[model samples]
Target: MQNFKAMVLLQIIISIFLFLSQASSQGIGDKSNVPEYAWLAGNWSGNGFGGTSEESWSLPSPDGTMMGMYRHLDSMGNITFYEFLLLDETGIRLKHFRPDLIGWETKEDFVTFEMVRYNGKIIELKGLIFKRKSENEMEILLKLRKGDVVKTEVFTMKKINKLK
Candidate 1:
């Protein structure tokens, strides 16, 4: 009777161990590939000189890919432009499409992006970089060049009680 009781206890312990082992083996999902900008994985509203713009970002898929779409409108509430961004193993790419430019403009915009090598408070992606200053605040820098002139603008986005 004692041997049978010991056998049952051993089996129970083994089953528990197997369950825990399997649970741990199930990866926590790779956050390494997730950039600082990942915090933007929701709806955002902001305004620039041009006008107000809204954006929406979604979580990365199982394969580690993320994308966001943004809409731009003038003070008159007319759709001025639309843009989208994609981040993947190859890096990050932003495509801007408006009334004047199509796919051809993507190449030119890509070339103007100035990429920084260091991962300081921010991570660099082409011409834009996102710096995580705190849990709720982030700074984004965008670089643009026209002719021989280079210009950069920094935009700070704060969480405003909305998630999409």
Candidate 2:
């Protein structure tokens, strides 16, 4: 009888603790605290010299962030390049992390950037402005110490059909 009572008490205490923990996680907070990257929620496709590539991304919450990854491989089935979405509080960012799996760790040319503007056409981040052409294309133009150059890339994605 005593053992049964002790087990019941323990179960009740555990249930209460679990309920409180879940409730705390649902508390209201600033939108930034949760992630404001809701623009990338969709399926996307693009092509380049490496070959055709596709990616998909969606956020768990309607007001949360979205992310995606893509792979473009060579004829031999070896990945020649890869790209992924980068969504931060500042803005939506994209990164092509690796050109090839071979010795990629030695390459420090990669950078971390965030979005500063979300006007749907021009996104400014880290003092650089990216112009958007259509829903899946963007170009970055900036002045360099050596000269001025413009880098352009195209992305295609559709918001998860199930989500409105």
Candidate 3:
């Protein structure tokens, strides 16, 4: 009877351990486990290859959607180009707009990227990634491929203003 009781207790312990391991593994792949990207909501400025660049991001909503705008300027402070970004249920989408407000993409089609990986601080899109170095600093890496040539642009931004 003593041996049988000991075996039963051991089985129970093994079962609990297996259950916990499975739960943790599942959480790693669950989207709900991702942290809210609300920290990105604010005004940011930085220098890029073109010149000074500014970006504004909106707070993430309860439904999981956030909007952002980016503008690049030349040394003379003239707006060179602008980009609109959105994060939604489908994924992250980006579109370029001219100074005249003309969109580079058609109404039916636009460039989109999926979140390949996202930790609390680093978010990796398909060809782009944003790493939040600290409360006041962030880095954006964009990879562009044309034919067989690939180029990467890095933008380091500093937080200029916090969202109200």
Looking at candidate 3, what is the lDDT of residue 80?
A: 82
Misplaced by over 4 Å in model 3 are 1-34
Q: What digit string (tens of lDDT, one per residue) describes model 2 on residues 48-85?
A: 44455555665535335556565765656666767665
CA lDDT, every model vs. true structure:
0.65, 0.53, 0.83
Worst 10 residues of 2 by lDDT: 155-164
The residue-level lDDT of candidate 1 at 123 comes to 59
Rank by TM-score, highest first.
3, 1, 2
Between prediction 1 and prediction 3, which has the larger lDDT?
Answer: 3
> TM-score of model 1 relative to the true fold?
0.62
Q: In model 1, what lDDT does residue 113 have? A: 38
- Candidate 1 residue-wise lDDT at 59: 72
Q: Which of 1 and 2 is ahead in lDDT?
A: 1
| Highest-TM-score candidate | 3
TM-scores of all models? 0.62, 0.45, 0.74
**Model 1 Cα shift for residue 133 (angstroms):** 3.3
| C-alpha lDDT of residue 56 in model 1 | 72
Q: What is the number of residue pairs that collide in model 3?
A: 0
